[model samples]
Target: MSKMSASNLKLLQPSPPQDGLACRATDGALSIKTVGKIYDPEGVHVEALRDCSLEIAAGEFVAIVGPSGCGKSTLLNIIAGFDNLTSGEILLDGCPLATTNTSPSPGPERVVVFQQGALFPWKTVIENVTYGPVVQGVMSRAEAIQRAREMLSRVGLKDIESSYPGQLSSGMQRRVEIIRALINNPKVLLLDEPFRAMDTVTKSASHQYLLELYSATGKTIFFITHDLEEAIFLADKVMVMTTRPGYIKKTLAVKLPRPRQYAMLAAPEFIAMKADLVGAVHEEAVKAFEAGEREMA
Candidate 1:
């Protein structure tokens, strides 16, 4: 069977349990409508997000960029079920997600690949990749290993199954992490600046691998990054957020053709898109800086 077909078959596999939550799946469509998040400390009310709204279709790769402390993480956390929005509702495939005491509901539909590496230092690459499925009993040990190996091979990561993360290059470790994420066939992949710590060269290579995998799997990717170019290059649409009490301030649709090429990064159209994103984000950044100054005063 073709890789896509195999992936489709894998998608039928059951999702593993998470935090006592029953595993369920979706096409990864997200609807963020008039969402608000507020925190109260010592009778002081602080708003992290206010009236934020967005519509993300299933299988669409969307990237978000914004000023520091602009509630980007807050929004992602809300969508991930780690927290609750004080106002509005988030729907998955038109059904609402439930939260407790506003506690997390991290299930299998959305998986977060964090900025910091979460790999086990003591485990081999294959071991780490197979860990989740095996532990959850969603897949037998043998089944998980077979799928994990296939995923690694597809990413052009060969013969490193026995290598420890400590022994691999930074870029290679990232590839392993990506493979680990895919073995679950999650409807959506949440990347929280997963490449932030890589050096330029390593980051570039990781980007290529990621784009290729995204094409093959057609997973809905919600990427959060400060690098505007990286966001544009990786996402079908880029959404920018306002400072402090965050909301979607602007969005740019990337017109670049699929099987995206590195050369396109230097193309005029790409440059123009980047300029637009930079301008939108810059205005918010300035606003954030001014807000900080006032707080200090």
Candidate 2:
């Protein structure tokens, strides 16, 4: 997908801060304090988020779920420094993230992977993977290529290093995008429904690959997805958001053991967790649907 499409999709669209949590900004991790976002389109003010707060531990994987248009993407954009929050602050490792410093700019410690793999079609796979490190001057060209090749091999994509993005399958392309972001070793990785468009088998494969990468890298990740099962299967904690003017409704811890497998989805604990989350999400979904109906009327 083009950058324009990604932005349009995002424009069309977490938790309470507490002490003692390793994710707490006070503990030198990621923190969100009463963050809010509003948009004025043609004099109509739309509130997207309200008093949203959440803290993620240094290496925690948190998956956020909410009704469509609940500002899940908006939250990700703010965390990524792509957009400014109207109210509240976001801090990374105890430092507030400046809203004015846009991404791919200097001193951005976060990288985002959109639903559509944002790859430069003209650049070969290796070049795309190494782009961030090269641009950020994080490593020399030779070192970047070496690191990219190693990451690709770890994810089983080493053989396609010379191919253009157009030459790879959708799944492969997504993996390349992930490697591209990961190569920078950013402190945080923001994923906006990266697997939503893939086939089930492909999505499942991507999930396992991501878990492996997360285990190896220990990078904190904020993942947004509408899939309840996916969230439970992949995240250390699953955060549910309410309808428009989104806020954290609940946070559920997934106790399933890792090296997680698809089979675990059938386990009693997994099913129970999904049941509770489904109930929470359904309540907000109803509210969102009613709000839309009223708006049309």
Candidate 3:
């Protein structure tokens, strides 16, 4: 996968419109219009999403939370262009994204980071980080190395360039994967429970690290997590989705201040917001559970 040329990069990231209205702007914006997805395996059809619609403003950090089997991962996959929508459309910068589109297939413009860091065991930290740029011929080996070092330093991993993935802690490996994605200057970053496998302490550290990274870069992010606290703490807006045949149930605006701290979780305001989201998610979970029981019966 080659990198987009400098001109193409500029075209993808035009400056935001002068209008103050968020809905009318398209620069770096993502719009999903009444999208639906269905899977038919062995002639049995299953609907994953139905009439789901959302619009994310440029540079917004949006987190989604829902019960298991709610098609969260499916939605993320569609946005990453790995899968196609069964109905409606997904537009980035007001341009539709489809599996058949001539637009470059799932390259640096939008990158998805999965739960596992997925680093190569044989490659050193710097090697893994620079792999994309080098493979794409976007930069020479020396230039890629230099760029990787700068990013590593920004994330405070300057000393581990030569170390392999096995030598670093799980948290460090996650950081490396994030840096690798960011090095491409992607317009959007999609995270699918990237911290799910980490211990509590490590998860907390990664949260802080991610917050710092977001502050520094202001990249658009769409994060999916089952953890309610994590969703509220990290996002400017929390979107809750219903069970299978999922559609967004509600979108909650988080008024929490920037540079959020762990202490904020204990505040009354934070607790109230969490309680509201918890109620919404609990309802969906109950519905999902009942549906499962019916299938078993």
Candidate 4:
């Protein structure tokens, strides 16, 4: 919540990012090694994850997609420290957060944005955004108000400080939630389908808003989604997980140029990437569906 001081903040790109891509520094990295999780509810021993290894570069955006019950949410929860991994190790920026022998408690370095709106309806926009730091005493109310205003201006919501969450458009409300998270200066933003509930038009607007925010701040993002297009569109890399007892089935590097644009969606590169993802995920989805059917029978 303290000021970054000019030296602590470095602009990785001289010019603001165009084409909707973030200009990021290479720190705040994440490493997951042979990660595994098993739920022992009544000793049912559900193996939710296994042998899952991932390397996420600091300031890079990565998305993970898989069918239902494939441990997508489990992995995100573990990264956010809401759940303990039964086995494996996780390190953030080379600091161990979780290992095979111990559980990691939640900390400020990671923050999550869920699909539902989290802004306090009773609080004005400015109040909601400033509550975290100001309440924690990390910053004086005056300083937090100043910082929140600057963040609002960056996201083009400077005029809405007096407005309540009930009045802002859904897209604008989501942006505020993001600003609230960014104000805390977390190392990674964990998004659990934050835009899944929006309609097409609203989602499109929010997508651009988020793309520009990511470019400007260079915050590393770990997104979990069922939407294949959303994953490929926003991530530097896309990871596809297998059926239950999930593991990384494939990882694709998006070679599409940064400063991303909707037109790119129709390009051969985008189409090819989507096709590849569809194939990989569909295979696993079929397996998951069959397993479910057998259980029902």
**For model 1, where is the 10-residue window of minimal lDDT?**
1-10
Pairs in steric clash, model 4: 18-259, 19-259, 19-260, 20-259, 21-259, 22-215
Question: CA shift at 239, candidate 3, in angstroms?
Answer: 0.1
lDDT of 2 at 98: 43
**lDDT (tens digit, per residue) of candidate 2 on 22-118:** 3333232688889888888899999999999998988899999999999999899888766777888887887778443433132435888988889
Residue-pair clashes, model 4: 6
Give the alpha-carbon lDDT of every model: 0.82, 0.81, 0.84, 0.84
- Model 2's C-alpha root-mean-square deviation from the true structure amounts to 9.1
What is the Å distance of residue 91 in model 4 from its true position? 0.3
Structural similarity to truth (TM-score) of each candidate: 0.88, 0.88, 0.89, 0.89
Off by over 4 Å in 4: 1-24
Clashes of each: 1, 3, 0, 6
Which residue pairs clash in candidate 3? Answer: none
289 Cα displacement, candidate 4 (Å): 0.8
The alpha-carbon RMSD values of the candidates against the true structure, listed in the order shown, are: 4.5, 9.1, 6.8, 6.1
Model 1: per-residue Cα lDDT over 1-297, one tens digit each: 013344543443434545666444347788888888898879888899998899888889999999888998888888877777788888777878643234558766677787888788999999999987887688899988987877777666668899999998888888888778777767778888889999988988888878777876677888999999999998999999999899998989998999788899999999999999889999999999999999999
